[model samples]
Target: MRNIKLTIEYDGKRYLGWQRLGDYDKTIQGKIEKVIKLMTDENTEIIGSGRTDGGTHARGQVANFKTTSEMTLEDMLAFFNRYLPQDIVVKNVEEATERFHARYNATGKQYSYYVWNAEIPSAFERAYSFYYPQQLDLARMEEACEKLIGKHDFIGFSALKKSKKSTVRTIESISIEQEGSLLHFSFVGDGFLHKMVRIIVGTLLEIGAGSMDVSAIDEIFENKVREHAGETVPAQGLFLDEVYYR
Candidate 1:
C-alpha cells in the first residue's frame, strides 16, 4: 500500500463540511473519495487533519489516504482536479511514509477569521468576511486576546457539552490586525475543539463592543460555563489557514 498526502484548497460555501456523512455527496471528503475510487477502482478513505465546519473555507488543508494503485503523483493530482467540483482544488500531491497520518501526526494549526468593519460592505468580500458595522475597541480586544494565549481548559469556548477526552489546549498566539475596513484575527494553536475559534472570536468581539467585560474570560474559565461565552460567529468568515507537522 502507498500512503498519499494531499494539500488542498476549497471554498466551502456549498459543502456540508470536511467529513463525509453517511451517503452524503456534499462533503469535501466524500467528493474526493468518490473521485479516488473512479481513478483507482479502490474505495480509499481520506483522513483530514481536522474538520472545518460548514461554510468555512481552507487555504492549506492537508489529507492523506492509502491506496494500492501505482499512479504517479502528478497524474493523481491532475485526475482529482479534473473530476472534483470547481470550488475544490488539489494544490499538491506526494507519497508519504507508512506511518504518516494526517490528523494524529499534526503538531499545530493556524486558523483565520475575517471581519468587514465598515458600514458599507464590499461586493467581492461579502461572501468571505463577516460584516459587523458596530464600532469596536481594538484595545479591549487586544487585552482579551492576551488572556486567551497559553494552555488552558478551553471547554468554555467550545461546543462540546461533555467529553471524556481532554479539553485542555494551548493557543500559542492570537494576533489582530486591521487593513482598511477589514479586521483579521489569526490563531495558532496546538488543537481546537468544535466551534472553539468561533466562540472565542465572538467573545472578543463582545468585549470590544462593550457588551462584555474583559475579565469575563477569567470567570468563564474558572466556572467552565458555556453560556458566559459569546455567540458562535458565522462559519463563512472562518478559514483553515494551514496545518503543521513536526
Candidate 2:
C-alpha cells in the first residue's frame, strides 16, 4: 500500500464540516471519499489533518489516504477535480511514505479569521468574512494576543463538552492586523481544541471593541473555565490556512 497526500481548498458554505458523520448528508471528507471510490473502484478512506466545523473554509488543508491503485499522482488529482463538487477542489496530490499520517505527523497549523469591518454589506466577501460594524482598536487587540502566544491550558477556549486527551497546547504566534476595512486575526499553533480559534477571535474582537480589557486574557488562562472565555464566533470567518510537518 502507498500513502497519497493531497492538498485541498474548499468553499465550506454548503457543507456539514470535514468529518464523516453518519447522519450528515454533506461533508468535505465524505465528498472526497465518494470521488475517490468512484475513480479507483476501491473502498478508500481519507484522513484529514483536522476537522473544520461547518461553514469554515480551508485554503491549504491536507489529507492522506492509503491506496493500492496504479494511478499516478497527477491522474489522481485530475480525476478528483473532475468528480468532486465545484466548491471543493483537490489542489495537489503526491505520493508519500507509507508511514505518513496527515493528522498525526503535522507539527503545526495556521488559521486566519477575516473580519469585514465595513458598514455596507460586501457582496463578494459576505459568505467568507464576518461582518462587524464596530470600530476596532487594533492596538488593543494586538496587545491581548500576546498573552495567547505560549503553552497553556486552553480549556476556557474550547467547547464545554469536549473530552479531548489534553487541554494544554502551545500557540507559536498570534497576530492581529487591519488593512483598510478588513481585520485579520491569524494564529500558528501546535494544535487546537474544538472552537479554540473561534473563541480566540471572539476574545480579540471584544478587546478591539473596548468591551474587554487586555488583562482579561490572563484570566482565561488562570481560570480554565469555559464560561469565562469569549463567545464562539461564526465558523464562516475562520480558515485553515496551512499545515506544517517536521
Candidate 3:
C-alpha cells in the first residue's frame, strides 16, 4: 500500500467543517472521501491535519490516505479537482513516507482571523470576513496581542465541555495588522484548543471596544475559566492558513 498526501484549499462557508460526518455529504472531508471512494471503489478513510469548525476556511489543509490503487499522483489530483465540489480543490497529491501521519505529525499551525471594521459593506469580502461597525482601539488591541504570545493555559478560551484533555497551549507569536478597513489577527501556535482562537479574538474585540479592560486578559489566565474570557467569534472569520509538519 502507498500513502498519498494531499494539500487542499476550500471555501468553508458551504460546508459543515473538515471531518466527515456520519451520513452527511455537506462536509468538506465527506465530499472528498466520497470522490475518493467513487474513483478507487474503496471505503478508504482519510486522515486530516485537524478539525476545522463549521464555516471555517483553509488555504493549506493537509490530509493523507493509504491506497493500493496504481493511479499516478497526477491522476489523483485531477480526479479530485474534477469531481469534488467547486468550493473544494486538492492542490497537490504525492506519495508520503509511511510514518507521515497528518494529525499526529503536525508540529504547529497558523490561523488568521479577518475583520472588516468599516461602516460600508464589502460586497466581495462579506463571506470571508466578519463585519464590525464599531470603531476599535488599535493600540489596546495590539497591547493585548502581546500578552497572547508565548505559552499559556488556554482553558478560558475554549468551548469544549468538561474533559480531561490538557488546556495548556503554546502560542508562538501573534500579529495584528490593519490595512484600510481590514483588521487581520494572525496567530502561530503549537496547537489550539477547540474554539480557543475565536474566543481570544472576541475578548480582544471587547478590549478594543473599551468594554473589557486589558488587565482582564491577565485575570482570565489566572482564573482559567471560560466565563472570564471573551465571546466566541463567528467561524466565517477564521482560516487555517498553514499547517507545519516539521
Candidate 4:
C-alpha cells in the first residue's frame, strides 16, 4: 500500500467536524472519504492531524490515507479537487513513507483566532471573525500572553473530561495583533487539549476587558481547575493554521 498525504483547506460552516461518525457522511472527513471511495472504490480511511471542533476552519490541515491505487499524485490531487466541494479544497497531494501517520507524527501546531472588535459588523468578515464591541486593554492581554509562553499543565483551560492522559503542553509563541477593527490571536504549541485555544483566547479577552487579572492564569495553572478560567469562546473564529512534523 502507498501512503498519500494531503494538504487541505476548508471553510467549516456546514459540517459537524473533521472526524467520521459511523456512516454519517456530513462531516469533513466523511465528505473527503466519500470522494475517495468514489475515485478509488476502496473504503479509504483518512487520518487527520488532529480533531478540530465544529465550526472551526482549517487553512493548512494535513491528512493521510493508505491506498493501493496506482494514480499519480498530480492526478489524485486534481481528482479530489474536481469532485470535492468548493469550500473544501485539496491544496496539495503527494506520496508519503509507509510509516507516515498524520496524527502521531505531528510535532507542533499553530492556531489562530480572529476577532472583530467593531461596533458595526463587516458583511465580508462576519462569517470568519467573532464580533465583540467592548473596549479592551491590549497591553494587559499581551502581558498575559507573555506569561503563557512556556510548558505547563493546561488542564484548567481545556474542556476535556477527567483522564489520566497528560494535560501538560508547551506553548512556543503567541502573537496578538490589532488592525482596524480586526484582532488576531496566534498561538504555536506542541499540542493542545480539547478546546484549549478557544479557552485561552476567552481568558485573554477577559483579561483585556479587566474582568480577569493577568495573574489569574497562574492561579488556574496552580489549582488545575477549569471553572477558574474564562468561558469557552465560540468555535467559528478559530482556525487550524498549520501543523508541523520533523
Q: Assess the local accuracy of residue 225 in candidate 2 as a C-alpha lDDT between 0 and 100.
A: 82
lDDT of 2 by residue, 160-200 (tens): 56664888999999887778888888899999999999998
Best by lDDT: 1
The models' CA-based lDDT, in order, is 0.95, 0.90, 0.91, 0.93
Q: How many Å off is the CA of 195 in candidate 3?
A: 0.8
RMSD of each: 0.7, 1.2, 0.9, 0.8
Candidate 4 local lDDT, residue 127: 82
Candidate 1 residue pairs that clash: none
Task: Indicate the worst ten consecutive residues by lDDT in candidate 2.
Answer: 158-167
Error of 3 at 91 (Å): 0.7
Candidate 2: Cα lDDT at 145: 83
lDDT of 4 by residue, 45-140 (tens): 899999987889999999999899999999999999999999899999988999999999999999999999988888988788888877899999
Could you tell me which residue pairs clash in candidate 4? none
Per-residue lDDT of model 1, residues 1-246, tens digit only: 999999999999898999999979999999999999999999889999999989999999999999999999999999999999999999999999999999999999999999989879888887888888889999999999999999999999999999999999999999999999999999999999999999999999999999999999999999999999999989999999999999
Error of 4 at 119 (Å): 1.8
Those runs of model 3 whose alpha carbons end farther than 4 Å from true positions after fitting are none
Give the per-residue lDDT digits (tens) of candidate 3, residues 1-246. 889999999999988898888979889889988998998999999999999989999999999999989999999899999999889989989999998999999999999999999989799888998888788999999899888888888887799767697888999998899999999999999999999999999999999999999999889889888998888989999999899988
Which scores greater on lDDT, model 2 or model 3?
3
